[model samples]
Target: MDDWRSQRIFRPVRWRSRYGRAESGKMHGCADLPGRMAMARKAKLGFGDQATTLVARGTRVTGDILFRGSLEVEGEIAGNVTGEAEAGAQVRVLKEGVICGEVRVPVVVISGRVRGDVYAGEQVHLTASAEVEGNVHYALLEVERGARVSGKLMPAAAGSGGDFADDAPTPGMPAAPK
Candidate 1:
């Protein structure tokens, strides 16, 4: 018994209570620890922790939407969708989604159809299934091979103070006067 008490393998068993519960309240083996820690970090950074507003398929919204965290659209929206600038806001339009009005967000991922202008403060990703009929204004833009945009693609000027003006002329149109 003295030899077993000095063994390292018996130390863990000795900490358990009569009910077989470990005093530390920690599991012996947990593969999801890393994933849980990652999620906790994301929550601390004010990202991926906020609730996501979803517009499901077969539904349609007629009024404008103003959000803070994230919005996922899988249906149709006839009005503007806007998110707070510099707030780590994000908007995602799924392949079955459709929007008929302007979209202004810090980050935007589009894989659907949009008939109006899009303004992204940080980045805009147009996936392969995306189709846009209006101009796109972005600080950083990525368009997949099959993505289609019928209007102008403009880059936001540095130090412009986040002003999204429709001053830039499109192709074959007269330039606006300064």
Candidate 2:
């Protein structure tokens, strides 16, 4: 154990209990002293569907990707990402991940940084730590409190291919400035 943690949490020391009695043993050595950590519950990855691809941390990819099922990005990608979402496919970018190009997938969960636009046919969820520098095209969108977007939010019309035209004004917000 590290010196600070050992002395602070586990080391026996002279202290008094809440009953106003002098305790002769460890400080905060009671059961409340953070005993064995409870086993964490298994998370349902990709909305209960297991991911079929993983761009793990410390890795980098420089080409566009085409995938099925689900893709979980924990690293970096510098190209476009297209996923087949017709069968409930999804893409998840974790907190430390980054994507520098466009993304077209069925569902997108972004908790990292995206430097390009995203097109989600089903839904797009941006968590509090997410940051997007390009527009997002989605059928449904969810934005958390601290998510940041530097581009427009365009709703994908029924037959529109999520055009990237700047002149198409989004609803609610005013037209993009020239």
Candidate 3:
């Protein structure tokens, strides 16, 4: 754990609890904190059926990517990504990752480079290593020291009724499940 923290990659804002951990706002230990992760519930399939989720790391994907399940990105994507996670699925962009397009997700933990627009339907987490150079639309946003966002920010657009956007349907804010 000490080595991980010393690497400058284990920053707090870069870490998130899996399985709906953010609702209670309890701080977990590390982004690389290792444990038996809960089994991801198998998502359904079809166009809107919610089957496939993609995570790109150390790779580059051109063109738009549309999926139904959750996506956790740690690489480079050159286009837009549209998907839904079960409340706590995080789209984490590591310091080495670079995204060059629009991102629409429920929760995002950014620690890398984003060259386009970002839309966080639930919350946006910006770590010290994050460098964003475009517009952002988020319901909630958190930025640490050294994090840079050089664009417009639109907050809490869930209730605005625009362009297929809708609020999260959960009764209360989701927290990481124990």
Candidate 4:
């Protein structure tokens, strides 16, 4: 257990290229070190860490969640999630996460799978790994190249009641106009 190879956490690694300074390359005869920009592809709606909550990987929640501050999901949620009335409330779904119900928040950063509608009063940011199967209602939206939204992309004014529940599509019918 004392061996470094048995640790699950990442250890900082620096490798020297042909030049004198440390750069990204193979280390001696071993594999390449972790890149410095490894986290650059992640999603961020700018809510920061005012407060934080975690739904960890391999865990599942069966009921709806109402939260304040930030909720970070790296697992599966079988119900809806909503943020509190205070400002700066947010939700982030990581690459391996999945949410099977609605998400209502001021800010949303999704890099995983969402199977229901999303209402973002402030902003919605979808990364290349995000896959959303339901409608997205947002004041502002940012989508990377590979992000996918199967339902409507509905943009509403900041205060015009964007979280309309009646927007669901009728079975076997054409989608609503944008």
TM-scores for all candidates: the values are 0.65, 0.62, 0.56, 0.63
lDDT of 4 by residue, 18-87 (tens): 7688743333423442333333322243333466889999999999999888899999999999997464
Ranking by TM-score: 1, 4, 2, 3
Q: lDDT scores for all predictions?
A: 0.83, 0.82, 0.68, 0.83
What does candidate 3's lDDT look like per residue over 137-174, in tens digits? 78788999999999977776456522225435446878
Which segments of model 1 are wrong by more than 4 Å? 1-49, 165-178
CA RMSD per model (angstroms): 10.6, 15.3, 20.2, 14.6
Best by TM-score: 1
How many clashing residue pairs, candidate 1?
Answer: 0
Runs in model 2 lying further than 4 Å from the true structure: 1-51, 158-178
Candidate 1 lDDT over 1-178, as tens digits, reads 5785457443432245467965532243234357768987877776645658899999999999998888999999999999887557899999999999999988999999999989988899999999998989898899999999999898888886445755565689987442
Model 2: how far is 86 from its true place, Å? 2.5
lDDT-better candidate, 1 vs 2: 1
Better of 1 and 3 by TM-score: 1
Model 2 C-alpha lDDT versus the unseen true structure: 0.82
If the candidates were sorted by their lDDT against the true structure, best first, what order would they fall in?
1, 4, 2, 3
